[model samples]
Target: MSQNYPNILLIDAIPFQGGSKVATRTLLHELTTEHQLCIFTQTPQSWQGLNARFYPLYMPRWLINKDQGIIYFIKYLLIALQVLLRKPSLGKITLAVGASGPSVDLALYMLKPLLGFTLMQLVHGGVACSKTNARCLLRADSIHYLPSSRASMVAALARYGITDMMFNEPRFTPMLNGLDKSEWPSEALMHSSEPARPVIFWAASLLKWKGLSILNQALQELNASDANFSEQGFSANICYIQPKNIALEYDEPEDDSANIHWFNQPSNLDEMRRQSSIYVSTSQQEPFGLSTLEAMAAGLCVVIPSDASYWDLALIDGANCIKYRPGDSQDLRQKLEHLIKHPQLMISLGRHAMFISRNYHAEQVYLPQLQVIDSYLGAGSSKAQASITGVF
Candidate 1:
């Protein structure tokens, strides 16, 4: 193995779409400056000076969903075959990062025998039980957790009858995912002694897991309350920023449209979040809340589920943000009402939220990834090989 910078194989099954793909692009843009990076995808992506980008055999274009699930796994498998055919020499590539977790796992399963590259599985603690997870966990040379709690991973591994002691070797890289500071405001806006605008802003994908139904129920109840003074020319106090709004988007039986605004995704989300007094997220078991982080950066009182999965990302319910019971509209309404009545508490929590969010900035957060890469490259194949293969 040469002492020069080791090459890296970076594969995100679905490129040019979604949070995971966007995260892939961000890391590629950052890492390409120093390390050579080769990305394999069914989708074409252009990155100047990137080592290589390959588009292997894939399903027809029409079949590709931006939210493609099982198809992504198949694409990764095909890409793996193509990469294996390339026949990378021993020590040619020292490390590989799985940007698209499930898909990458399938690819690495096939590629492990063909390539000696150290495999790292990027995880958000727990994944839903699947054949993909069972296969991938066996091949990961190292586990790189993104704001993933060790306890959760341990429990997840236990599902496959894999004990922690099996991979007790020094083979874990714990890091929080990075957020682009530029997307957020320069500084948190100070709360004035005057009251904040009586507005609540929410942004999320219109999905059941996102807990929109619960939020809609809360709004339905809230709109029935005194906040329904919109008839007196007051603007809707609840503005839901999703392409397809919740039930309140269309005319309902109670005609609650006046009290709730169903707006499309905003062009300038940061500015929109700043204009609002509070930002709420109802996602249950969210891996990492990027939109929630943006709201925190904007100095808005951010509220989320009490059992939000990523607790280690400095999310303390009453300390920096508010946590309401998941799927309980009554509890959500009560939490928001408390913030409405206590202006000082809102300001205090918002300020703390912004402070906590700064730690997630790309500069502060991505360092661990870079370090993990460097350490792997520095150690080379013989000495620092992780137990990428673990038997049950």
Candidate 2:
């Protein structure tokens, strides 16, 4: 409700790499085309193309002696007052909190009464699953977006009465829980003229939740089968040969079986995409499976774990991609065999996946957010009401 577009305040913690970064950055980029936008971030300059500056929440202590408790509180209070003094007008102030950080959320709440602003939280996985996160989110005015697929998350939310009680009307805005599309491999990188090995790519943080152990087991099975093929008169070329010595961090296994390649760190996103044929995800639970999307965009056929509630974000067990039971090494091994045996099928799947990924582009996602902003401004809730109730 001002003559000018609202001045949106984007409050986020530093290092915007995951869901929080992508969602917030996309929205800000879109809104800046028309609306006035200011970003307050811990890492102000890291993210490109933003009107941003570092916001210091604590004052520097000039005294020789250290301060604690009451003095610390007083110093923080001064910082809060400084932030408050710069608050945009009632209608112009729309604070968007992306992370589930309690301190940031609470600070936004304290500002609501005085600023007469609108507050929105870009909800990801934490709020719907954790009671503590749900309670923190109860302080916001609107939930702009979510990482969960519409069906599964809505059904789960119904159990908690979040459908009807949390807000006047809940809107399930779908968002990818994975990496930013901008970070995906480029067209040239995906369709390089240089031939790559028949790769079964598994890229992640190499942590337990990512299912590295299961992947290792699958590799063993693939190698065993490759050995059997070689014994039965199959040429070494016909058998899948997994290249070792791919990782600089870890030692090359002395006996890395044929058809099992282990990659550690990739210099860039394109390199990871280029050196692979089929990208497989072995995560026990992935809210949005960002790596899966990135692989799809890179034109790599994907085989993902079907255990997560959010697995439906990109379909599983079909033409576009394959899905095995989460943490099931046997299932993954079988899928890998199918892909290697029929490389053409894998290529087709990769093409289809790349086509489907076009919808997730930043330009398209940003358009819907502009609609949300228009709706919020039209409501004319000048009091900055942050009652996070649900609507069934």
Number of the top-ranking candidate, with lDDT as the measure: 1
| TM-score versus the correct structure, for each prediction | 0.73, 0.66
Q: Per-residue alpha-carbon lDDT of model 2 for 1-392, expressed as tens digits?
A: 23365566655433224435544664555443345555544455434675444453443434112224455345434544656766533235644444433333444555667766777666554443434345445556666545443443444456555763444355435444332334546642335553343566665554345566677777766667767642331111111112221211221222344445444343454664665677777666665665677777778878887775464455756778888887789988888777777767877788888777765665454445556666765643221233323211
Candidate number of the best TM-score: 1
Q: Per-residue lDDT for 370 in model 1?
A: 57
- Cα error, candidate 2, residue 282 (Å): 2.2
